[model samples]
Target: MTRLYSQPPRIDAGLFFLRFTGCLLLLHVHGLPKIFHFSEELTHIEDPFGLGPWVSLLSAIVAEVICPLFILVGAFTRLACLPIIAVLLVAMLFVHPDWSIAEGQFGWLLLIIFTTLAIAGPGRWRVGASQSREVRYGAG
Candidate 1:
């Protein structure tokens, strides 16, 4: 039977690349703006669930800014992805359901990237990875 996976080093490298690039794009495009322009974002953020604008904007900041930082460093990556995924899902599905695929391509693409990371994890290149390995596989 054919091998189902690449070598460890290659897989780790790919995971790191995906995490780094995806998180970086999210941080740069969405996270920083929400941070630097807090008041402006407050004015425009969608309150899809009628939770109020402050709650909505704060939720977005947590997901886009704080969560990406965790994912970027490969710590609690799967857990971190949950908020990002939730926020993107809300934005795409609830807040902007009228957007055509072309109009919403970026959000959809980010969803794909983060969803992939959530499934694949940060691989062996992650922070505390050695500790996890030692625990899971026994000391080598």
Candidate 2:
């Protein structure tokens, strides 16, 4: 039996999977629809910080779409995940708590995943994973 942590490749693969899947969920399941329907959705989304729906929707699009795409390619994985994690926190803790705990739970799960990917990185299988790891961890 081989423990997953005994190898770097396993860790890298896990990171890659997490990075790809989590971001894909944020992009396709969440962001893409809103983006495609931007005109209608612009003022309909939540204004968590009272920033107005337009600003809020734009923020969500960036966090869930632009950043996730960066994460998907490992181009700037950690930097990308930061906005998403922040948005999730705002959504789960501040915004949705007034509505329902169930909604918050989803945010929490994604928060955990993004945090993990932010910490673990996109793995060596990714485009710039090695360089990112070195810059982030001070490793060679």
Candidate 3:
């Protein structure tokens, strides 16, 4: 029998899966609930930061629904990350400044993750893969 080394695969597939799952989980756990549950509250509350409730609602919808959809499909992943990053920044500065580490840490983690996604962009298997290649090749 051929000698089979004991080492695991070298491709880091688990890392890719973890990143994708983490993005989806974050959007579902944090963003989706807030979007669905807080719609009325978001509409009525006077935004203290001068963004106003309508703008806040729009931002939340974009971040929670639109961005999460894109992230799940890995379509326009970098573009989708922008709204999430903005939302996290707002949350960090306005909403949870005094919260405990567990409560507040997600914003920071999202910031880092989204920022990285924005920089590196969606990987090879994303919905945008063809578009990415087209852009690189200057095709229509």
For each candidate, the alpha-carbon lDDT, in order, equals 0.89, 0.80, 0.68
Instruction: Estimate the TM-score of every prediction.
Output: 0.87, 0.81, 0.68
- Decide which is better by lDDT, 1 or 2: 1
| Per-residue lDDT of model 1, residues 1-140, tens digit only | 33333346788889999999999999999999999999999998889899999999999999999999999889999999999999999999999999999999999999999999999888888877773342233243
In candidate 1 the C-alpha lDDT for residue 31 amounts to: 94
Residue 110 lDDT in model 3? Answer: 72
CA RMSD of each candidate after superposition: 4.3, 5.4, 8.2
Candidate 1 overall lDDT versus native: 0.89
| Superior candidate under TM-score, 2 versus 3 | 2
List model 3 lDDT by residue over 1-140, tens digit each: 34333323332243346448757867687667766777665757436478788887777777867786777667777788888888877788776677877887767777887787777665655553452232222233
> Per-residue lDDT for 93 in model 1?
95
Model 1 vs. true fold: TM: 0.87
Candidate 3: stretches off by over 4 Å: 1-19, 38-40, 43-48, 100-102, 128-140
Clashing pairs in 2: none
Consecutive 10-residue window with the lowest summed lDDT within model 3 = 131-140
Q: Model 2: how far is 62 from its true place, Å?
A: 0.5
lDDT of 2 by residue, 1-140 (tens): 32232335677778888988898888887889988999888757878677788889988899989998888888888888899989888887776767565746667778999999888777778764343333233333
lDDT measured at residue 85 in model 2 versus the true structure, 0 to 100: 89
